[model samples]
Target chain A: MFDQLVAKLPVGICVVDEQYRLQYLNAFFLDRMRPDQRHNYLQQPLISIFPEQAKFLTRRIKSVFVLQHPSFSYWEQRAHIFPFKSSRPITGEETQMYQNMEIVPISGPSSEQKLACIILQDVTAQASYLMAQQELASALKQEHTAQRKLIKKLDSAQSQLIQAEKMASTGQLAAGIAHEINNPIGFVTANLATLKDYSEQLLNLCDALADKLQVTSPSLAQFSAQTMDTYHYELLKEDISPLVDESCEGLNRVRDIVENLKQFALEESTGWQLFNLHETTQQLVKLVGAQYKAPVYKVSCNPPNLQIFCEPASIKQALTNILINAAQSIKCKGFVKIDIRATAQRVSIKVIDSGVGISAENIKKIFDPFFTTKPEGMGQGLGLSVAYTAIEKHKGKIIANSNPGRGTVVEILVPVVHPEQRHECAEPLGGS
Target chain B: MSTESVLTADQRDALQELMNISMGQAANSLAHLIETKIGISIPKIASVTPEQLFSMISEQADAYYTRQSFLGDIQGEVMSVVSQQGLCEVGALLEYDAPLSQTDIQEIILELSNILAGACLAGLSAQLALGTNLNMPTLFSPRKANFEEFQWSNSLVMEVQFDIEISSFSMRVVFCLDDASLDRLTQTLDELLG
Candidate 1:
């Protein structure tokens, strides 16, 4: 019964003598040994049985016997102590059995003699489970990153939707107001024309009155007639015409702002055209230079007559976001240098700012969406990432270099798309 | 009371004598095993802010850094800065494979830091008759240390560099003691001086 019980245990058990020789092994261990090994393993050295770990294991085993202390060998730091296959050769899922081993010294009565007993545990299932868990955790991490990206994109789309909704309602309000103004404008313009003709007749009558007043040569009567006649002519030709012109200018300014607002709200642009790069750069500089402080902006182009076919509106928004970032990076009076170079296949634009720069550690992660170092409400951290996406849409690359207290430089290389190659970005297919 | 003021020259002299003996013992232990001549510089003791501490480490190239924090009745970290120059040669002398990866280099650094720092602290503490617990060593990036980000400002530092002459490898081991431990260390040194 005891033998059967010993045999029933799953793993092979072995005990070695002080001299690194395998002196005893359980029935299970004996049975699992190869047919060739079983014939010769009796009273054989442990090294002979396991050839791979011979040198290291022998040295370790010597330490246990010498120190007369219990020693442990963990599969945690180094698993697979012995490369033995699983017992279930035909049906077992396991290819290799993970092992943990511990060695304890058994002292004999002689001062010179000692013995060490070694125990091995099969940890295949635990190792595989741990590996699977590690893989699962890593996969979850990757999925989490992907999910965060999707959520950021969703959030941007949501903000755009909200802004577009507001603009749409505002446009409706403007159209309504325009409708009201148009009716008044039509009649007022007609009335002004009629008024002008009336004023012309009145002025003619006044001129005749002035001329007649001058010829009569009666001082008091001529003075009263001339003062009244001059007043009528002055109202028509001198003051009223200029007032109308000034009002026209004021209305035109409002109309221009509303038109620009409409253009900015548009999600799509129908036509792509070859645009002057220098003119676009100047327009962008003017747009941001009016708003930000603490930084002076300078622009230089290598080739003046360079042009690129692009959606000018989207590209302009991208530039505006970046310039704003550069301006904000500076704490004190700092210089922002913009260098543009046109190559055969692409245009390279570099925006550099002398400001509080990024640290080396944070540089790698800056391109990740929503990873911002700016203080609360100063930035959403989405600007550079959005710029990245827009440039990527044009099959371009952007890089950032910075050192603390020195400055930051962002370089962008955009492939100059030809007119034939300009295509609108396709919307994501699924609503999700 | 002066808030992390360093020891005076006489105090430094007494502390240096204690360190010299302990460092010698540690070097003897390493030399016995590696069979190579190792040299230790006299301890240059100072009270430093954490920023100066980081700059002290970041200036070395082919050099990797590791830090081990010890806690007992007192607590602080021991930073071991090891140079990469002739490391493969030294690694060969120590029986590691050539052309190490960063992680392999890191593992080697951890092992070396554990051994040397463990010996150094044990020797120093044994001489002063104080108890100190040495923790596991981990690789550190010196340049990434933003000292302003740390809560603690001043530290009592005992810094020394050891060079193995058989090979061109050099390593600097620094001991940073907290305020309470500084008091303990100075008292212990005073007792040894007496």
Candidate 2:
């Protein structure tokens, strides 16, 4: 009955004695091994049957005999020992079966030899689940890179806007100064005209006197005419014309500088409007970049009138910051491109520049307060710090993608807020 | 001094008595089911290594090995040696019919080890008034170990043999403790004996 039961077993049953020879191979074992080896391998050593795993099995089998302890190995460490084809050849996911083995020392009067037993279990499903999790982690790492660049651009625009604000205020002051200077120059010029008329009258009277002398007293006329000419005409005319021209020229230079400053610092209405994304992008690029002469700025928002509802002032500030950063990143003329995409739910503004990309170590600190890559006095390093502040206020997200020496791209997303949702003067940023 | 010296003679006797009572209960659980007379050799316990075990059971050349471990107030493993002869009859008595496949035989051994080892440990702990936990049963081969390479000294071992009076069935369960645990076991046994 025991012999019959061994033949009827579901799994392969093979027992090897201490000498490592096959003491018994049940029907299950015969059904799996090489057909010729199945018959011949009987009573033969297991090593001669499978030569590839010979060294590994030999060490393990010997340990079992030496320690007199049960030893086990699973598919987790070594998946395939005997490369038996999957029991389900047609529909199985695995080509080779995963196996587990056990070794034991059997003691009895008739058989004092030790035996080794092997069991196999399939585990394809669990392995695949673990692989899927790794893929997700890698994808997250990629998305995180993209988010950083947009934040950088926002920071730059903000800093540029601050500069623009200073320039604009200075421009306003220049205009006021021009008005105040004009007040005093008005009377000065009019009085100078009247004094020239009086001087002409006095010259006429002197001329008349000189004629009278010429007729009455020829000697007196000669003396008087010479004296008057020495004191008057040629000297006065020489001094006046050049002084007037120079005063006019100096005032004009001051006016021109003030105009440029005002343009740099232009402020718009605080409310939302359907502003043309393309036009605003151009204006922002021009405005911020006008002060920073470093990087080349390019604008491409095709269908130029791509309109979106946003506070134009803030949008300009955001873009200007990005463009300025692009400008600073380039040692020579490098391109900075502004792209605006309008959709039903939001607007995406991308500022891509061929600037020095942020380094990995510094990228983490980019959003940190007062972190700057600029030389002292050039910047307070509040650029990206402020950018992060603005993006958060707008319920938007900005990201950066940078490759050192290659370029950096900042992507900004502005949610389409309904009329009621927009807040004015809600603080530019909560101080990043 | 020696790890064994901690166990006084009186404490050792008490521990042996506790083992005899637990083994008696374990044998009864099997004997009542098989409807056969069951006999247990005076209970002997030992501290042994895999190599030491190989020689101890040299008489049962073709026998199967099954071990179950328990832990709680005290922790130890119950290793059973089943003689290859007439095991099928005992397997049948355990509700596993004859025509036994290798796996079926293994399954019966593990199940038998679980019930007997679990119950015996429970009884032993109760006799000592200590709580314990029993782990799962696992099969092993003792002859695979190299005795020469083994570094353990001749251990303080208390050994026992159990025999099934009917159906040619016989087995043994050896409870081995580490040296530190042996000392603790002696102290607990002394307290109980007192």
lDDT of 1 by residue, A19-64 (tens): 7888666666667567788766767899888887775467557645
Quality of candidate 2's docking, in CAPRI categories? incorrect
* TM-scores for every predicted model: 0.50, 0.40
Interface RMSD of each: 6.3, 14.4
- Cα lDDT tens digits for candidate 1, B66-117: 8888888557889999988878876765565667766446656665676677
CA shift of A299, model 1, Å: 16
lDDT of 2 by residue, A1-432 (tens): 998897777655667777778777777667777778766675798878767677557755664454343445445445666766666678866677666655554553476555765443444445444446677888888888877887886766676567556745764675576566655656655665666666667657766787799899988887886786787755654665666556656655444444444443444456666666786566566556657777777777745688766666666656666667777787777788888776778778888888878998888787665678888888776666566666776778888888998998889998876554444424333333
- Best candidate, lDDT-wise? 1
Error of model 1, residue A49, in angstroms = 3.0
